[model samples]
Target: MSEHKDLNKLSAAGLLISLGIVYGDIGTSPLYTLRAIFNTVSEGGQTINPMMVLGALSCIIWTLTLQTTIKYVVITLRADNKGEGGIFSLYSLVRKKAKWLVIPAVIGGCAMLADGIITPSITVTTAIEGLQVKFTHMRVIPIVLLIITLLFVIQQFGTSLVGKLFGPIMLLWFATLGILGMAYVVQDLSILKALNPYYAAHLIITNPMALVILGGVFLCTTGAEALYSDLGHCGRNNIRVSWVFVKATLILNYLGQGVWLLQHPHYDLRLNPFFQIVPEPYLLFMVALSTIAAIIASQAMISGSFTLISEAVRLNLWPKVRINYPSNERGQIYVPSINWLLCAGCLLIVLIFKRSVNMEGAYGLAINMTFLATTILVAAYMISKKVPRYAIIIFVAVYGAIEFTFLVGNMTKFFHGGFVTVMIGAVLFSVMWGWYVARRIKSRFVKYVEVEDYFEIISELSEDESVAKYSSQLVYMTNANFKTEIESKIIYSILQKEPKRADIYWLVHVDVVDEPFTQDYKVTFLIPGKLVRIDFKLGFRVEQRVNLLYRKVIEELVKNGEVDIISKYTSLHKHKIAGDFRFILLEKHLSKFSKLSVYERSVMWWYYFVLKKLSLSEEKSFGLDSSYVEIEKVPLIFVSAEDIILNRLPA
Candidate 1:
């Protein structure tokens, strides 16, 4: 959606929409959070008791308070770029100020994506695991696999129909969580005792597996970033207002689950407290509701991944792949490569781990890395925005320690499938880093020259009737920032590669800016009617449709007396027909003859590999039609070879 969506309204409808899109990830966590904690404690050989339950409940309450409430909703939400908010949005704001900020942005982006894999695997498996509550011998893996596969397959069609149902369904989901949780909660009013901070502290200090339990507690807030990422949709007012109700329901449910566990100290750790708290008649109904909500949660995760990759491509942090907007829904996109890749990951985790309890170990850890990276970026952003230094210090110190402890606790999970998410993050980060570094290296070598020096030559060639006419109109996509500056290769291409003349020369430059939705252009008649320059200042998120935009610019120029577009041929000029325009695109290749360092060689090797495999050619990427385009290869000389040794004697 356009980041400028009007989400500031406090109306009930806004809140309901917020309930659907914004809260899906965090709202559905109750289905599996306690179950994961119990599993972790049981596997750690720790005794489960009322004290432990109270402590765990207290930890969940405070974590939601400190991590989700204060840090993200209150602090990070303030860092939105115009109306868009995400790592890339935040990075775009501060990246110009700090060149190195790209590192953390890529890290945060990749880690968030790695977390995407486990969110679906764990939440979907957990909801399906509820089925075993009715059929003890049911094989849930097959069921989970089916659900996961269908989710991916339907992505191509888009989710407009079912997506509309998400709000009412999630509203129902949260209401049910409150009602069921409150029922058990009233059974023992004393269960409210867990709300005290002492129990949470006691659990962490006295219990041996407290850190592991805390790791599980983290799952409850893993989707907290989604709340912020979706800020543009629901607006801060709607989200902040709705979060009050959502958080209350979530906390009550956790407390009620604690109450159930306290009463049944001998309860099997594998049995879900979420389902058990519901009345017998509603057990099947509860499973059905949980499954639907889990799917919505998974949908939010998948959609967020698409947005992330799309932004990464725009920001040059990741390679460009085909982006499909199935419907006209803003921000609703489908990337086949990413979609199928995530589907395979979810399926693999479901097949190998085979249970939500197992997937939980692989979750949270990668998200914590995301949390930490965002914190780092936020700190830098705060500094850049001129927030008070003292306030920034306090903000950083408090969240820093909390997230680091969360990180250390989760570090223990590396050997136990946590390595999966971490490894995925590392690999994804490397590919992005490789792509980014290669660009920086190339920037050091690409040649630029003053177009003023070639203007006389170009004018002379244009009128030289002895030279062949290349086309009525000639366009070249440029890297030059100023009208006077042009790439040296463009000069060579016209003067040496194959000399040609044209009546009018068009230099089109498209600038991808930091904003999310900028599309303005400037035109300068460098030589009045004979030569013109069009500089398009487009936002990074904008599609690079230079062909269509160029046509539009030409029409404007023709109407404004800036230029004439009638063909040079006398017959076409009488009919008022437009001249033919051909675009020349420069394609760079790493020269086999050039010398390079090991790092430089590796970077270029992977850069070209990624270009061929992952990215569209400039002609296609820039919205140029192949029929009217010409591709010319240029050597990328990072370090030119020294003088060659004389071989005259040998010859």
Candidate 2:
């Protein structure tokens, strides 16, 4: 079994890596968060009230403190699954406690994936919007689109080289944020009064647009979920320690922006406060640096999307998709289908929204669902750990109200592009929900029989001379968990289909465990040399390359003198040639003769015809060679049609 490295140990490199990977999204939030907040309240170039400024600033401070720092960085990080910390990873830990928990896991997974589309579009566009400060007439759309196209294009070649510079670039970016923010904060130390919670409460009670302001405020902590998702890449302690530095700079920058706002209460809403604070001499350089930072943030989100979908596929929450390892780096992966799809979605968002300000609503709405979902899973996790009842209730009550309020605020943008993200999340959720439920519906009818019932017959079939040899060793992939049992379809394929004869029969089962990197296999020799069953227990994050893994198991078995692979033929055996192995895959299809309710039929239609068509084929998904694999179509009759009347006409 492969062991996970201890990236959690506190060290300089670990902190640097955490800066690059864990903070990309939140680190870049300063790009547009305050801009969106002021724009919401200012309305039609009106003078912005001083209370709005101080209250909004106070809201931003505590939101980051409670939402990002306390809930995620401090508490949720404790729910790590063997050093992994995503909604799915958290769900995997508590799924057995309650089957209903899958609802939140799937919802959270789809919402985060949907967030990937807008994060790139908004961050890059907002950063490039800085160009307008120097060149008022510059067309930002074309430039933003070009940058995004280039970013997605490089995904296939791997980013290890470019990835190495991410830590340093982000480090510089955060430093720039702090410097520019401090330059303004010193001019008006009184703006620091916004840090008081009283201002936040005053705004909520008196401001009519409180919900709208909150929708904007939610953007600051959007990356908190991503912070937790990347837990495995950089351990918990690294994140915790780096977050202190990250949060300090973020607060300083936001405070600086507040001071700038206080100095000019009626400042032009067209200009972003984030860029306005920058000294004119460095505006262009700042714009260029921010664009690069935006790309890094986008890349991290895209890569995280691939990892999320990969885990979903292994856990059977999603249909199998082709996953490619473009680099030798341990966790780096590329999914061509998802990569291109995300690219197209991003381009579409740029074309429709046309400005970073227009995307704020969509971005906030999409990620708010993810925040709520994570809260649910984390609460369930605390419950599983047997935390005190009062603590659990307080945790849920406080964060639940916080996130739900954010959701309501985001909902205000439904007609104004929020629906864009909602619709995307819905489509993604349907696919995941359909895939999971359809599997349950199908599994309910799958037949399993005791393997012991057929051991004697399988042994005899291997020795039957009248039957033609299928292969020296014939293997069948089974879904049965216990070594004492096998899927009935596999038995039907072997004995009833063609009466296949072979020197040996092998049944292989794959069990995806909750751990992230487990890779252990158990081999049970039912009839030593004649019949065998191998169970491969893999972690959710582990790739299921059955062909390669099966071969490795055979090699180990042969080395231990538990099996013989030499050709059984008289001539080939003398030459010591290797035996041939063939794999049988029984593909299932919906049977027309089966009776199904309208809901089941719809789910089956989507799962089989839609999701199944979109997914990789069984042979390719399992990493099996086409030449050595055979697929037999099997009709899946969940409920057979009522006894047909006069079906036989005396034939």
Candidate 3:
């Protein structure tokens, strides 16, 4: 829990960092949000009415107030897993409280990932396309593709260097938004009337096509979910304090855009409201700034995806992928497989859409679904904590209606490129669901043996002269949770298969807990100096490495005189030589002779396939050095095939 507390401090530095990381997606919305709305309202390339501008501004304001401020910053932020925030972190907290809660968790997680793909495509494309205003006939696609390719390629090297400049750049970006908006706001001060809620209600209630237009307006606050996801990075106090300045600047910019729209009612969609509001001489500079901001936003999304996949692997909802800690900074991870996959997806979206306006058709649909999923999980959590039922009901009803309306509005664009993102979400969800279910089925067949039944035999074996020594010390990785029990296959591997003899045998068990960044252990002596068991309780977010933890535990034991790891050889002991240690790792396979149902067979087949393709070797997964680690194959006999009738025959 102290891990999350570190991020909760309120300070000037924290606020600045929060500004850069938390607001990228939502902050850059002004670049294209209004243009998308105008395109939606008048399909025939006609000028948008001044009243529609007022209505659209009103909708954007209310949506931000209700959806972003009330639901996320105020309510959802309160649901923290020891200061860590995100759908997966929220899921870990409430999953034990309600069994079916995983459905919302998985859905929310997948939707957010799908949002990752479309967001970078649209944001980068919009920013790059700005150059088209001056350099007519210069192809935007090639430039956009180059920028995106470079963005993903740099992920492997980590972002700590470039990430430091993000805060100041974003601060300037917001300040620019405010100043530009204010300059235009004074030109037509009457545009401020959109601040009133009446115009928003009037537009949606009267306009026949308001629902379709609302879909495009939904993009204004799509990044609200990312704010909650990044809560742990900046802390609650820092985020809450920084949001005041962020929101104020955002509103001023929107008002400025509204004022500009009122004056130039006949402006083209290509002349985005965001850039048009800027001074004519600064257009090139603004375009450059927007591109940098968009890239920062893309970087945030990509990192978030890597974190989400890491958590999913720990929870058994996804396959294990290689996670690299490229920087010395804690929690900064790079997942190679996920990075390239996202790169491919982003490129596909850009090539298909060719421009930001077309990309808008697919953008908000996924994130709106994520918004609803977060609402459900947070409400479930509040109820589990015994918060007042009435308050929980109110929380659900208000956000539920707001998000549902957004979902409906987004559905208007379902066939018009919206299907692209939904299809991506479905694929991700299937992989997670399949992996999770298959793990549960495999766990049901695990068989454990009581340690008491073999304790005396193991003691005697240590003294036996007939058996050959495997090593001075033999260590095994086990799934057993209790000191008095171990996997049956371990007993078979020792007593029946090889008849291993050793001065000491170690049984190591790892338990992954719900907390983040927790790394603790307990030691038990099963047979005094002959055998021992070390139980490690690791948090889901912590790296699972037995070899490293094993060495630490050994060092502590030797210092305490609990066990001596000195060399067993007589001549080596006099020189104070360290004993040799070897580890045995088990890899389970579904047995061909087992009588499994068709469903079990199918799940296991896919499960092993996923593991082989996506994960590392058992030695690497355990962080064991290959030279000291030996791997053995074992069969998982869920149901023995008694149906296979065989009789004894003379040889």
Candidate 4:
């Protein structure tokens, strides 16, 4: 296998295009961040102090610079898995040494998923909200709904078509920010003084409502997780290079909003302050263009969510669902279940809130929790990896302090709106964690027999004239492990029913790794008797083509002197020495004996039933030829007291 590549290999031009597509979320925040901040302070047309607005704008600029730029781009991007970075990437890096931190990592990942839902809702809603400045009577909800519906509808087509336009459109979006902001900045150069950190410090320490303000301000950095998660897609250098332009444009636009606010203290630009800076005649066209831009931003997050969930499923951190790689491009995939789930959630959020401002109250919790979780994981990574102690201490202190403060600020909004986000995330995380635990328990109880024992049985059976005449080799495809319940069933079924065996016994186990590319076969020979066992670790990102791999494995075994190279395992062989394949499928049916709580049993049953319908067809999942493949279903019973209660409980 080739060594993993890094960001340095990409050309400068490729990096720029990658950045525009990957960093679109953080890049697009200027469209709504300033408007969100001012809306919080200027409730009901209340005249806000010019100094306060400047102070808030100053805080927004410095926060992006310090929290997003320095913290994420400079420090966080350095913590990557091969070249991938995300909550799971960081989790994989630190989980071995800092196992205790997995809880927080899981929580962070759950919150990031929640953020995925709310992002598109708020982004599209805010863009549509800008319509009021020009149309004055345009229906906002319908437009927002239409934009979101179209965003998801296009996801099935993959990103290649829209991806090319993402760079140039976002480039134009950032340029608009600069041009509009400069127009306002020239009117009052005094707004530049707010750039000093002291003003933000003063506002926080002196103002009683600073906590709420900070909570609102936290929305400005909501896309920081997107910056890290998309690292694999865009590469680290592309994101870093792109952020230079993205961040500068964001800061200038924010300062320009401050300049505009300072001049028009009584003006209620409740819809969107960013668009207010533009000339009135062009504001409608800007809204139309921005709605398109916002939809693109939302699309990027939706795509990123698909990739994250795909990785989660591969790592066994999340349950298996249907995953389709719509593009030959390395990381492009579409998960129908997740895509629809997010669309439904975003639609509900938009309908319930009816405005981006209401959704804003709920947005920061997921982002803050995700950031805090990442910091804790990063600190653990530093210590375990034997990085300099002083560096760990200093970095942790800086990041932890900011993270804690933001967590508290975000928590303040919990009952008001943040609770909704947390609840949704909790539901998802619980399902994933529950499934993981159940799988582990099932694995633990499985009976394990030595390969020597099975090989000895095969050796004895090979000598029997009746057994040897049936088939040349026995190939059992099983979902369970080599020594688990399925193995026993395979043995019993062969002896009691057919009463025949084959010349060779092949034990194969296939594991899906969370990489973009992987080899087809990894062979192991159990010694003394040289019992052949092989593991085929395939990449989840690759198509599951069993026949192709089987051919390669047969070739490899022949070269290794394990099998004859010339004998094809075709069904039409004249000597009737065709390879007999038995697929042992272990199906778990929940019963009163299963050891689950009443609630847990209900959840499991619900999952089981839903999965029965939604899961990929068994024939496809196994990559088997239906014409020749023989399948046997073996039922495994795992009973606990909870199952009894669930069965006895009234429906």
Per-model lDDT: 0.86, 0.90, 0.87, 0.72
Pairs of colliding residues, candidate 2 = none
Spell out the clash pairs found in candidate 3. Answer: none
User: Which of the predicted structures, 2 or 3, would earn the higher TM-score when compared with the native?
Assistant: 2
RMSD of each: 2.1, 1.8, 2.3, 5.1
C-alpha lDDT of candidate 2 relative to the true structure: 0.90
Q: Which stretch of 10 consecutive residues in model 3 shows the poorest summed lDDT? A: 39-48
Cα lDDT tens digits, model 4, 471-510, are 4545565444443224555565556656655555556667
Pairing residues by index, what is the TM-score of model 3? 0.95
* Residue pairs clashing, model 4: 593-639, 593-640, 594-639, 594-640, 595-639, 595-640
Per-residue lDDT over 1-651 for candidate 1, one digit per residue giving the tens place of the 0 to 100 score: 433656565788889888998888899899888988887787777767888888899999999999999898889988877677888888888887888888888888999999899988888888888878889999898888999999999999998777888999999999999998999999899889888999989988988887788888888899999977887677888888889999999999998898888887778877988888988888889888998898999999998998888888877778878788899877778889899999998999888898787787899898897788888889999999899999989988998899998998888777888999999989888788988988887777778998888888888988888988898899998888888888888889888899868889889998878787789999987876767899999886777788999989888877877787788778999899888888998888876625667887887888887655677777877778999999999987655545556456755
**Top-down TM-score ranking:** 2, 1, 3, 4
Name the best candidate (by lDDT): 2
User: Cα deviation of 466 in candidate 3 (Å)?
Assistant: 0.8
Is candidate 3 or 4 superior in lDDT?
Answer: 3
TM-score for candidate 2, please give it.
0.97
Residue 304 miss distance in model 4 (angstroms): 0.6
Model 1 error, position 184 (Å): 0.9
Error of 2 at 583 (Å): 0.3
Per-residue lDDT tens digits of candidate 2, residues 387-493?
99999999999999999999999998888889999999999999999999999998887889998899889989988888889999998989998888888888999
* lDDT, candidate 2, at 408: 93
Against the true structure, what is each candidate's TM-score?
A: 0.96, 0.97, 0.95, 0.88
Point out where model 3 deviates above 4 Å.
Answer: 1-6, 44-47, 592-600, 641-651
